[model samples]
Structure formats: structure tokens, C-alpha cells
Target: MAPLIAVAHGSRDPRSARVVTAAVAAIRARRPDLDVRVCFLDLNAPSVDQVIDAVATEGHSTAVVVPLLLGSAFHARVDLPGVLAAARARHPQLAIVQSNVLGHDHRLVDAVRDRIVAIGVAADDTRTGVVLAAVGSSDLRANDRTRALAAVLAGDTRWAETTVCFVTSTEPNVGQAISLLRSRGVERIVIAPWFLAPGRLTDRLEAAALQAAPDVVFSETIGAHPLVADVALDRYDTAVVAAARTRLSA
Candidate 1:
């Protein structure tokens, strides 16, 4: 069986790391025979290089890299590719497959929507507002993907207003987003974080939203949700299928 590496945007928060660790464990439970390891792109231990070396050392000639990121942003495009390139050079005989970034999949969207409902926001009531808060990205494309996801939830919940806000690099940071919703006559505001971890930024986002509107509700960060685990496994499966096709054509 091929080795699998789960890569995440590491966090200083131990809870964040545990979430990813648990998610990988769930994946392993489903496929007990496969070799699986978890690592981070940066800001934590077991870096991408470490994971690659470990896989090669274990006699695995081919490995799949599954990024646990929510959107295809800088890390997914540049950082992840650079890590794979370095690993490729170090282990020339090893075959490495980089899978797609986890972004806006139906399963993930459903998870967020479920969280919103759990926050006491009536699904049928059209008077409430929802703000899909995320750690912003400089990549416009990535930000757009998050906005599209918000639209999906908006369509399903039929909230009075659905806006996408960021912790950085975009307009209407959480506070302003809440104000916008209020201006539009929304009765209640729900801030749903699109982050996979509870880090400093996530704390700041919640604080700001609370400061702006004390009545606003902030949902839990999206980490290790069963749906998210499913999405990660789906990404790995896609890479496996792609690797098989490449070998067939070769």
C-alpha cells in the first residue's frame, strides 16, 4: 500500500494540532492497512521535509500529500509545490502526488451550515444574518472561493443577509461585516469561522465581533469535523486515481 501524508497549516495552539491529528486517525481507522503520517507546512514540528524523509526511509517509493487547508491559496499553490520539489530532489526514486486543496466541497459546506444551525439560527427565519469569517488570503481566487461557499449556505438557509469577512487582507473585517448586516435590518448576527484551527487570529476575530455586537454568536472553528475528514480522504483518493492513470499512460 502507498504511504499517505496529511499536511496542514500548523498552529501554535495544541488544540489545533490535536484536531488534525484526530482527523488523520479517523482516516486511518477506515483504511487500516495504509501507512499514514501527519505533518505541517510550517509553524510546527514534523515539517513537510520531515514527513517526506520518513516516508522514503520506510521503503515507500510512492506517497500522496493531502493538504488539510480549506482553500487553494498561497500555501497550496507555492509553498506546497516547493516542499514537494525539495522532497522529490532528496528522494528521486520516490513518486510524490500532490492532491487538491480542500475547498468548498459539499461535505465541508454542509458542516459549516450545520454549525450555523446549531448556534440557534433558525433555518427558515429570513431575518437573521450570517457572516462567513475566514483567515483571508492575498490570492483573490482563494477569497472568491470562500465567498462562493458563503453564497451556498445563504441560498440554503435563506438568511436575510450573507456576507463573507476576513481576519486579514480583505474588506469588512468581522466587525464591519456585522455592521453591514445590521444596516440591512438583520435581527441577529452569526459569525461562522471558516478556519480549521483556533489560533490567535481566530481569537481576535471572535473578540472583535463581540466588541462590535455583544449579542452576536460565534460558532466553533471548523476543525476535524467528520465531513472535513471525509473531504481529506476524498482528496487523497483522487490523487491515488491520478497516479494510477499516469502510470498507465507511461
Candidate 2:
């Protein structure tokens, strides 16, 4: 079987790497025979290039590169493709098939709901407002995807209201979202970080949420959840199967 290379958007915070590592471990636990490796796109060690090079050196002719990203933003669209192209040029013998970004999966929604519930918010709490906080992107469509996810969560979890917010790069910043909720007479607001791991952005989101409303509840980052491992494997399998079909057709 081809190795699974899980690539994440690295962070300066060490906790972020740890969470990603844990998620990879979860994947290993689920499939002990599969060879799974973790790499980062930036701010951490063992970059995507390094991982690809290492896998090639280890005698793997083909491998699956799964972007552990939640949206089709800059990193997924531009950076990852650029890296893979460079890696392919450098190692012509290695067949590195890239997978799609992890976007808007129901398992992810369940993960977010699980986090909110862990923070004492009931699933049917119609009075509690939710602010689905994420690291904002320069692309409007990417930000819109976050809003769509918030809408899905609102409907699925039966929260009174769920609004989208960003920690950077876009409108409706965390403070603004919380204020909007407050204006809507939602005294009990919970800020759910739509992140797979804890990092500087999560800290900023938490601080902003507390400043906006003293009694605001903040959920933990959705780190190393079993559902994430499932999604990673799904992406890997999809990529591998597609690559096989393409090769056979060629």
C-alpha cells in the first residue's frame, strides 16, 4: 500500500504540532498496517518537501499527500500544489498524488458539535448563540464557506443562532460576531474555534471572546478527534484509488 502523507498548515505554537501529531497517531491506531507520516507546510519541522523526499528515498514509488486543511483557501489552492510540483520535479520517480482539502464534511460538523457539547452547551440549547470562529482568509469564497458551516451547525445542533467570525483577514471578527449575538439578545454566547488544533489564533480568539462578553463560553480546539482520523483516511483512499484508475486508463 502507498504511504499516507498528512500535511498540515504548521503553526508557531507547539501545541498545534502536538495536536496534528496526535491526529496522525489516531490514524495509525485505526489502521496499524498503513504507513502514515505527518508533515507541515510552514512554521514547523519536516516540511512537505522533506516528507516527499524521505518517502521516495524509502523506496515508495507512489504515495498519497492529504492536505489536512478545512477549506480550499490559499494554502490548499496555491501553496500545496506548488510544493507538490516542486517535489515531483526533484524526484521524478516518486508519484505523489495530492488529495482534496477536508471541506464541510458532516464528521467535521459532528466534531465541532462535540466540542461545544463538551463545554457544557446542550445540543438543543436554543437560547445560546454560537460564533464559529476560524482563521480568516483573504478569499471571500473561503470565508463564505465558514459561514455555510456555521449555518449547517446551527440547523443540525438546534442552537438559537450560529454566526461566522474570523480571527484575521476578514470581516465579522470575533468581537464583532459576539457583539452581533449580544445585540440579538443572546446573553449566553459560546465561541467555538473551528480549528483542528490549538495555536496563537485560538488564543487570540479566546481573548477576544472574553473581552466581548465576560460570561462568554469558549470551546476547546477540535484536536485529534477520531472523526478527523477517519476523514484523513478517506482522503488518502480517494486519492490512491483515483491515481490507480488514471494509471490504468493511461
Candidate 1 lDDT at 246 equals 95
Residue runs of model 1 more than 4 Å from their true location after superposition: none
The candidate maximizing TM-score is 2
Task: State candidate 2's TM-score.
Answer: 0.96
TM-score of 1: 0.94
lDDT value, candidate 1, whole model: 0.85
Q: Pick the candidate with the highest lDDT.
A: 2
State TM-scores per candidate.
0.94, 0.96
Q: Compose the digit string of candidate 2's lDDT tens values, residues 64-122.
A: 99899888888988999999999999999999899988777878878988888998999
| Clashes per model (N, Cα, C within 3 A) | 0, 0
lDDT of 1 at 22: 81
